[model samples]
Target: MTLEFDLFWSFRSPYSYLATPRLAALQEEYDVKINVRPVYPIAVRIKGFFKQVNPLWPPYLLKDTVRIAEMEGLPYAWPSPDPIVMDIKSGEVPEEQPYISRLTRLGVAAAEKGKGMPFLYEVSRIIFGGVKGWNEGTHLQEAAARAGLDLAELDALIEKDPDHYEKTIAENEAAQKAGGHWGVPLMVFEGEPFFGQDRISHLIWRMEQKGLKKRS
Candidate 1:
């Protein structure tokens, strides 16, 4: 039987970007499937989350993510235009988030089309891999094409019933919390949660214990 896991991820998360490439590799190399459950970032999902965080947390996070990306040998940088609309200093997330809302919804649309992993990996690379103005021009369009999907088609899917996509995003957030972590890169296999990009090894270990095998 093929093992499967639900990956609760966010487009705005650097860790999610860091985790994606290896996750993509895993599915190709092993007989497993990844259900990419895209969710809004904590900045939007949890009110006062950033403000409540320790003042040192932000800088530490920046330092940690950069090092992790380097360790993983994946190109890394913050998104050119951050997906979330928020004030960094005050840690205030605005209600009107134009970028993340669409991205997260489109993630659901792609997943519905069975192109979740590739779509996530490709789009995220464009966003977090130092592409300037990643959202402008045809960066996303090109990324979608590389993933065997079309950006316009996915956008049209969302437009058909945007509420459907929004509902899925919200449901993913709820499932993330129920899966025992409100964090991105949360991987849950058979109800066990491994949270963080660093925890991907642990997840693989568990999968191997359960007889995971390389694909033919």
Candidate 2:
């Protein structure tokens, strides 16, 4: 019996970017399929999640992740311009309704085409792959191409049909019903839920315990 894991992820998370390449390689190592499900980040999904994060979260997370990158032997650089959706103005960051909305919609669109992982990989490269920077006038088009994707076509699809995109997000929420979690980067395997990039190893261990057969 083949096993499949649903990996719910968000593009804005640094950890998500770090986990992408490794997750992509797992297909070659295990007899299982990873269904990448891109979702809105907590800041977008929850009204005030970011504000509630620990005061030291930003610096601490940055320091800790750099250590992880060194241990994993991966290039680590703070994303240029950052992938966050909020904007600071008048000494107060605005709600960032539009940006977050667009990201969530686009994520759903990619998932609908069964190209979630591909899209995530391409997009994350622009944000975290030590590229110049990812922004409105950035080289996103070129980056997408490098990742074997087409930016123009993806934009058209999302622009032309938004309802379908909304539905995909809804479907993901429903699928997580059994797991009792609504967080991104949530990996659900055999009804067990492991959330966050840090949980990937645990997820693989669980898969192994469930009789994950190694390839011959």
Candidate 3:
């Protein structure tokens, strides 16, 4: 039987961006499926998230992500016009976010069309791969095309029932918490959660014991 896992991810997360190419590669090399479940970043989900955390966390996170990208030879940069509209200096999240909501909803639409993994990989790469104004112009449209989706069609689909997508995101978030973590790139296999990009090897080891096979 083919192995399967649910990846709770976020477009606004640098870690999610870091983990995706590896996940996509695993899908190619093994008889497994990754159910890409995109959710809003913690900055949005928990309004006071950054405020409550240690002040050192953000600086450490920046250094850690940068080193990881360098260590892995992955091109990385903080997204321009971050998906979550927050004061970087103040650690304050705003009430109105113009980017992440639509991006997350469109992730749902892509999954509904059976193209979720590709959609996540392509889009996140553009966003986190140093593309300035990644949300502008044809960047997203081109990414969608690469993922075997059309941006306009996905947008239209969501416009028909935006609430449904939002509901799905809510359900995914609830399920994510149930699966063990509330963070992006949380990979769950048979109810076990591997909650970081650094845990991919651990996740693969577990999958191996479960009889993962090479794709022929």
Query: Which ten contiguous residues of candidate 1 have the minimum total lDDT?
Result: 85-94
Per-candidate local distance difference test? 0.92, 0.71, 0.92
Quick one: ranking by TM-score, best first?
Answer: 1, 3, 2
What is model 1's C-alpha RMSD?
A: 0.9
User: For model 2, how does the per-residue alpha-carbon lDDT over 41-142 read when each residue is reduced to its tens digit?
Assistant: 666566666666676777898898788778877777777765564642222235655554565666666666666666677777666667654656747676
Candidate 2: the clashing residue pairs are 8-185
What TM-score does prediction 2 earn?
0.83
Cα miss at 73, model 1 (Å)? 1.6
Model 1 has an lDDT value of 0.92
lDDT by residue (tens digit), candidate 3, 65-160: 999899878889999978888887788988887899989999999988999999999999899899999999999999999999999999999999
Candidate 3, residue 191: CA error in Å? 0.8
Better of 1 and 2 by TM-score: 1
**Per-residue C-alpha lDDT of model 1 across residues 67-175, encoded as one tens digit per residue:** 9988889899888899988888798898999999989998998899999999999999999999999999999999999999989998988888988898888898888
Candidate with the larger TM-score of 2 and 3: 3
